[model samples]
Target: MQIYKVGGCVRDRLLGRPVKDKDWVVVGSTADEMLAQGFRPVGKDFPVFLHPKTHEEYALARTERKTAPGYHGFEIHASPEVTLEEDLARRDLTINAMAEDDDGNVIDPFDGQTDLHNKTLRHVSNAFVEDPVRVLRMARFAARFGFQVADETKLLIHQMIANGELEHLVAERVWQELEKALLSNQPSLFFICLREVGALKTLFPEIDRLFGVPQHSQWHPEVDAGVHVMLVLDQAARLTDDLAVRFAVVCHDLGKGTTPADILPGHKGHEQRSIALTHALCERLRVPREISSLALKVAEFHTHCHLLFELSSCEVLNVIEGLDAFRKPQRLSQYLLACEADFRGRPGYENADMPEKAAFQACFDAASKVSAAAFVNEGLKGPAIASAMADQRCRIIEQMLKPFRKNTGGTAS
Candidate 1:
């Protein structure tokens, strides 16, 4: 059997990116032969093995035929007779179809290297429309690499959407691709790419509807809610690599999309509306509770976070307690990051300093230090102890904001 490094490893290497994982394609290797050689079988639908020593994945060179709709309705064939060329032809993008041999020889059967040089994402074959997941994957790659989708590939993606292939995509697979996109350096490109191909409407209608929605130009110079969210996502990526934070930023403005048209730019009470939409979107996608919880909290409290300076110490503490900041300080920090992203996402404000973030963080730190143990020490029980804790935390917050209130000539509410 001849083994060659294939897929993303080769693609990233050619692009001068750090190779994160190595996948091998074994030509002229049977599943029984691989098992005999101590390669552990891991693939359920195809012949994929793990190296005896390195434990790296080794998938047999195989070809696939489209049998039905979606990504799962494919007939996979792996045998000693399957050629590596045939296997590579089944790949989604040209850049990902290239492979490399042990002797350091680059295999370019589909001109993937040329497309890589051109900074283009091109399809390998007409069979690209067979799997809907490929559309998401390609969009994610565009976000990661900042590459332009070739005209032909764009047409194929449009055709796939027209054929209703995207409707067959399952929620888990959609979220899997979305999570990857959210973690990319330019996550907004992921949504832009999907919008270009009309897949966003099918997969994320809530987000898609935001494109043409108007926003107050005074606050959001970008003027479109969709563009504003994309800017927020990019800013969020700049602040943290946490997927939960990124996801929260993405869903924070969903309520704005549902604003009454007569209201035009004003989004009064949108925070509550956003909470409901966030829940629906999360439930539909089967998002994890941790992420959904954080997103919901951000959706409901982001406005409160922005209005921290105007709120009373008690109100600020209430927002902090609503976020469970005392128990999970990291969530509070993440919420601040998402809010900062939103605040700076507008045009001519990208570099604006956020004094509110620091002020809120300081307030949270002071309040978090007020221990409930002291109330318990005074023989306070249950609701009494909880009441005492709230009073003490609010007092601490009040003291913490005293200096800032002087500078602004504002009194506590």
Candidate 2:
């Protein structure tokens, strides 16, 4: 059997990027032949094996046919007769269809190298629309490499959306792609790509609806709610690599999209609306419990964090308790970051100083210092102990934030 390196490892190498994993396409091979050669059987739907020593995946050259719908609607055929070019043609993108021989010879029958040189993301063949997941993969690749999708490919994506291909995507697959895109340096492009192709409305309508919505100009120089949110998502990526924090930033403002049109730019009481929408989106996407919970809290209390200086100590304590910060201090830190992203996301406000971030951090730090052990040792029991601890925590936080609260008056928004 002859094997050639293929897919991401080849594309990344050509772009001078550090290759993380290697995938090989083996031609003139059968499943039995791979097993006899000490490779471990791993692929469920196709003939894929693991190298005996390196344990890297080596999939036999196979071509797939669409059987029904969704990503799993595929009929795989792997045989000795399956040519490397045919296998490559079945890939999602032109840049990912190239292969490399062991002797360092590059194969480019699909002109993938040319697309790479042009910084373009083009489909390998018309068969690209067979799998709905390619739409997300294309957007994710754009986020990763900052490559523009070819006009023809973009048209194909629009067709996929029109023909209901995107509606078949499972929640798990959508989350997987979204999580990867969020990790990229410019993840905003991923959402923008989906929006441009109308796939956002099909897969993530809550986010898609945010595009034409307006926000208060005084607070958001970027008046479009969707634009403001994309800026926040990118800013969160810049500030921290924490997926929870970044995801929180992505969902923190969903309520603004659903605001009453009569309210126009003023999104009064949008926080509660955002909280409900965040829960629905998380539930629909089957997001992990930790991630969903953090996102929910950020959506609910982000306003509290942004308005920390204006809140009384009791209100600040309420915010802390609402976020469950005393139990998971990480939530407090993460919530602060999400709120900071919102403040910095507006146009001309990218580097503006947000005192509320520092003030909120200080409050949580003070609350952390107050111990339940102190109240328990004082003979308080059950709910009494909790009440005493809350009181002490509030006093500590209040003492720390006296100067800011004094300067900024009024109740929490």
Candidate 3:
């Protein structure tokens, strides 16, 4: 039986990145043969196993058929006769189609190594049209690998979208891929590409409306909602690595277009209104509730950072306290990073540089070591704690002393 290292592990090794996992493609080996070699069978519809010794995945050579629409319609056939070439041919992208022998001889029948070297993402075969999920995967990979899709591949994707092939994808899968894409270093590229190919409108009609929507030119010289979103996404990548925070970056300020005026003139509670809109958007995208909740909280309160310059130490702690009452105080750092990124995305709000960012981080560091006794010892407890904790005195005090609840009350003014 010939066993070869395949897909991402090998690709990452070639790219000098840490290989997260090892996967194998086995040719000339049956499922029974794999089990005989002490591998645990795992694949339900195909022949895939986990090696008993190394606990690495070993998938037997298999072919697939599209019995219906969407990604789940695949019918697979596993056999000992399937060749490495045949298996690689069915792959989505050239960069992911490479394989290597036991001695490390690269098997690249599709010139995937060249594409990898050139940083180009291209489909391996015309069979790419068989699955609608490939478009989303392309967008995500473009963001992940920081590479552009090949022209021919882009053409195929456009054709698929035109034919409504993407409608076959379920909401969960769409959100899953969208989540990864948004978490990438340049999530805007994916959204921009999706818009260009018309998939953005088809999949997310609400966001599709965001493209041509106008913002106040004085504050948002970026002009259009889409560009503003892209700018925020770029800054979001620089802000934090937290997925929920990044989700806020992608979704915050989404309500701007819904206003009657060209500029959201005389708008009140825009932040709170946007939070509600973000929740609906996240739900429509099928994002998990916990993540959606974080996004909404961050979006709702992001504007409060404007008061950070005017805040007292106790006031700062109070703001922190109020935030902590809703979620983990540790997440405040993430929220702050999201705010910093959002501010940077705007025309004149790029003032928070490394020093400013570090100052905010220092507050988080200090909060982490702070305890209830520290508050009392500092004579900062009870009525001395500031009037913002009027109704939440005990709750706020408990949270202040509690290491995990640093942001529970005291900063409304």
Candidate 4:
């Protein structure tokens, strides 16, 4: 059996980037031959195994044919006759279709090297549109490498989306690609690519509808709600590698997309609308609880976070309690980061000063000292104890954050 290092490892190595994981393609081998070599059979639908010692995935070279609709419609044919080139041809992009021999020789059967040098994500063949999931994968690759999508590939993805391919994609697979892209260096590109081909409208209409929508010019200088969201998503990517925070930023302004036409740029009480849309999006995507929880909270109160300096101490305490910061301090940390992204995600606002995060954190720190345990010790119970604690926290926040009180209304500093 001949084995070759294939796919992302090859692409990343050629691009002078760090390779995270290695996938091998074994040509001229069968499932029995692999087992004879003590490779553990793990693939349910195809001939794939794990190396006994290295435990790296080694999939036998195979070809796939569409048997039905959706991503699961593929029928795999793995055999000794399946050549390496045929296997590479089935990959989503030219950059990911390249491979390397054991002697460190790259095998570029489809001019992947040229495309890589040009930083272009082109498909290897017309078969690129066979699977609906490629629509999301292409966008994900764009986000990961910041590479330009080839014109033909864009057309092919559009063809796929236009023919209801996106409608057939599994929600889990869509979220998988989205989750990975959100953690990428240029995550906004993922959604941008999707929107370019109209797949965004089909798959995530909540997000896609944001593109042409107007925003309050005074607050969002970019004036387009969708552009604002992309900026926020990219800002979240820059601030940290936290997926929840980035995902929250993505959903924070979804309500703006559904604003009344007459309202134009002014979206009053958009947060409440945003919360409902965010909940629907989370439910549709089957988003993980940890991620969706934060998304919902950010949707509900991100503006509140922005207006922290102008808010009364009681309001500040409400934000802290709403986030349950005392119990899950980590939530507050992530919440603050997402709010900062929103605050700075506007044009000419990326470097603006945001004092709301720090002041609110200070408020939380001082108010956290007003413990329920102390209230309980005073024979307070249930709602009475909660009210007393809320009052004390409000007082502490008022005293602690008084100096930052201003009419900034969380706008760009």
What are the clashing pairs of model 2?
none
Q: What is the lDDT of residue 197 in candidate 1?
A: 74
The lowest-lDDT stretch of 10 consecutive residues in candidate 2 is 260-269
Runs of candidate 4 exceeding 4 Å displacement: 261-268, 376-379, 406-413
State which candidate has the highest TM-score.
2
CA lDDT of every candidate: 0.89, 0.88, 0.73, 0.86
* Residue runs of model 2 more than 4 Å from their true location after superposition: 261-268, 373-379, 406-413
- Candidate 2 overall lDDT versus native: 0.88
lDDT of 4 by residue, 1-413 (tens): 89999999999898898999999999998999889989999959878899999999999999999888889899999999999999999888888898999899999999999998898889988888888888788889889888888888888887887777778988899899999999899899999988877788888999998988877756785558899999989988889999999999999988888867555322445877888999999999999999999999998888877777667788777777789889999999999999999888988889887888888888888888777898889999999998998888887887776566634433222
- RMSD values for the candidates in order, in angstroms, are 1.9, 1.9, 6.3, 2.5
The better candidate by lDDT, 2 or 4, is 2
lDDT of 3 at 274: 71
Higher-TM-score candidate of 3 and 4: 4
Q: Give the TM-score of candidate 4.
A: 0.95
lDDT of 1 by residue, 1-413 (tens): 88899999999898889999999999998999999999999959878999999999999999999999987999999998989899899999989998899888999899999999999999999999999999999999989988888999889988988899998989999899999999999999999988887788888888998899888655675568999999999999998999999999999989888877555332456776788899999999999999999999999888776767678989998889899988899989999999999998888878898878988999998877777788888999999988888898888888888887787676775
